[model samples]
Every structure is written in structure tokens, then in C-alpha cells.
Target: MRHFSVFGAAAFACALFAGSASATQEPQAADILFERPQLEKLKGGDRLDYSYSFKSADPSLFGPAFDDRIGLRVEPGDGPDKKKVEVEMFSAERRRAAGPFEDMSGNPLLSLMLEENLQRLAAIFQANPRYMKTAIRLALRNAKATPEPSEGFGDAPGWRVEVAPFKDDPHKARMHGLDTLTYRFRVSEAAPGEITEIAISARDAKGDVLFEETTRYAGKH
Candidate 1:
């Protein structure tokens, strides 16, 4: 499973998280950053929600840019920075599908189609691709939260995460691409403040193992 050779798809997705460069400025530092709302900042078990959007740096991915929102909740912690997270849901509307041609790897072409027509003069409008951006949703609960490392994931701070598809989801059972996903996060163990490795694997309605991964924190945060 680790050597699936999903390099092309993974790299393509990575670019979407990394922001695009502007003519007058250099590229931004992070592709994605989660911000806490004013309400979540309050203490005593209050939950917080926020939205995240992703766009590809290269316009060639699709005719128009893609954007989706993910809702998240943070549990109130005793300390100022302490928090527990709940990934509520993700939705990808106007998602694209496979295209007609193939790539260098002789793989079928795929893309996320946009709902909105592109502006004739825009760069994105000119470089249309076969992929469509889809909305992703999640129903999250007060699961245990872990702390990330100080340095960073891959040498910094964060644990790896794996999310399984919901039972009601149809296509996930049919396609390999839609099965499940794993992520690495910059967080550490909650108690004893010791850096640790984390992995999550969920089974489907049929009880088959669906998602799993392992993450380690190198140093204290």
C-alpha cells in the first residue's frame, strides 16, 4: 500500500494546498492554515468552527479555480493553547470526473470540473484540465486529541492521521481512489507532554479495515 506509486495524484493534491504565487510577491509559506474563531477562543468546553479552501497554484488543473469548505470544532481546554479538534464535515460541490485522454504514465485523464464558466480573459479559463473539485463533508465528534512535535512533521511536529469513508458513501466501496486517506499532523501527546506517534484506521460497514497510518513526534513542542 505504501508504494502505490500515487506520486502524480499526491503531488497534484499537494500543490492545491500550497498557495499560488503572485506577480508582485513570492509564494506563500503554507498551503493550508486552520484559524480559530472568536467564539472558540473563549474557555470552558465551547466548540469552535472554521472553513478551509484549496486552490491549485497552476491554472492547468482546471478551467476555473476550486474551493471547498471543511467545518471543524475545537474543545475548550484548561490552558490557553490546549485544544481538542472535531472535524465536522467536508463537501466538494461541482466535482469533476475523468477525461478522454491519458497522461505520460498512460493513465486515464481525470479532473474536477467547475460549475461556473470561466472569464474569457483569465489565465485559468485558458488552461482547462479534466479534473473536477468536489466538496468533502465530515461528521466529527469529541474524539481524543494528541499534541504534535515541536520541530515539524517529517522532522517537525505532527502525527499522521487516517480517515475512513462513511458506510452510506457508495462510490468509496467501488473505487480505490475514493476509499480513504491518511494525513500527518503536527501534534503531541496530551498527557505527560511526551511526543508520540499516532495512527487511525476505521472499518467500513462490512467491517473491513479501511484507513490507517503511523506518525511519530521527534521532540517536545
Candidate 2:
């Protein structure tokens, strides 16, 4: 499962969509990205084009309290705007990990492998479109809160995720000799297309932010 806990915590959401006009609603987190028209063409097992950038971590944050910036880029399947998008690019950054892990940097080979693995993951994600729905479903199953119903548009209401510090290492202090850690994300409402807002946390599991930051979507093309 390749760290399903971390992936689940980070990749929760990204599977909701609705074209029907409604009212003002809250946004939900997503594991995949897609445009309105692209979502329409989905058959239960269709793949989607997806791209995203992770926020570079500032060494200063040095803890689960540090903010993790994440961006999602989705290309529609086949429609008038199949190549276009509703939100175009959705970006957000929030704290995810509070403590430091074994920085494989000490080993040049391992560091290189990390980079290669990341690229491999990207290639696999793009080649296999079914990953979109699979990622979202996995995230939802791991979320602490249940998904909320949507009212209208904007930020589809009904999704929230909460994270607790690690039981063995509450402060996430590598100095404290921490072991494995796990956090939780609760779903309140689900944003269909773009992730309008997210309030997830990272810690030793004590509900503390070694780093934290909130971001907004600029609807950038």
C-alpha cells in the first residue's frame, strides 16, 4: 500500500462532481482533479488526466506542524472544454508532517531512488486513469468524518478532515526518538471539481502544528 496512511491522509477527497446548478456550498478535498465536462464522460471505470505539484517544505518548519502546499491540475476527458477546465488549477497548502523522517539524503543512491520513485508514481498515475477514483475512495475510507451533502456550488458543503498527532511521538521530535506516526482527516462536505478549502493538521498526534498555512484558489489557467 506504500504508506497508505500518509497517502490516505494527504490524498483524501478528489472524487466528487456535480453539473446541476444548485446553491452556495463548501468545498471538499480531492485525490484526483477533473473538469465539469470531463466528469460527465466518466463511465464507472474511465481514467482521467491528472497533474499536481507539492509545496516545497521550508526546513525551518521542521515538524509535522510545517505547512504542506499542494496543487492539483486536471484535464477533461472529451468535451468542448475537454482540454479546458472549470477551476483550471487548484492550489492549497497546509501543515502535514510535524517531525522529520530519516532524510535518505545521507545516501546518494537512496536519494536518487526517491526521486525516481516519485517520477515513477507520476507516470503510473497518468498512464492508469482509474487511479483518480481509486485514490478518492481510499481517502474517504480513511477519513475520520463522514462526507456531507452538497447544497449548491462554489465550495460544495459537507467535508472536513482532522488529524491527530502520533501516539508514540506526540511532539514529533526526532530528538525524542519517534517511531511510525499516523494522522486522520475527517470529511465534512465534498467539493466536486476543485478543492476550495482544507483544514487538515499534522503532529506527533497531539493536535499541534509544527507548521500550518491556509491557501486560496486563484482559478489560474
lDDT (CA) per prediction: 0.28, 0.28
Decoy 2 TM-score against native: 0.32
Q: After superposition, how far is residue 100 of candidate 2 from its true place, in Å?
A: 29
* Model 1 lDDT, full chain set: 0.28
Q: Which ranges in model 2 have alpha carbons more than 4 Å from their true place?
A: 1-74, 78-144, 147-156, 168-194, 203-208, 215-221
How many backbone overlaps does candidate 1 show?
A: 39
| Residue 79, model 2: Cα distance from true site in angstroms | 9.9
Q: Per-residue alpha-carbon lDDT of model 1 for 76-174, expressed as tens digits? A: 444455544333223545332222111111111111111121111123334222211221113111112333344432445433222332334554455
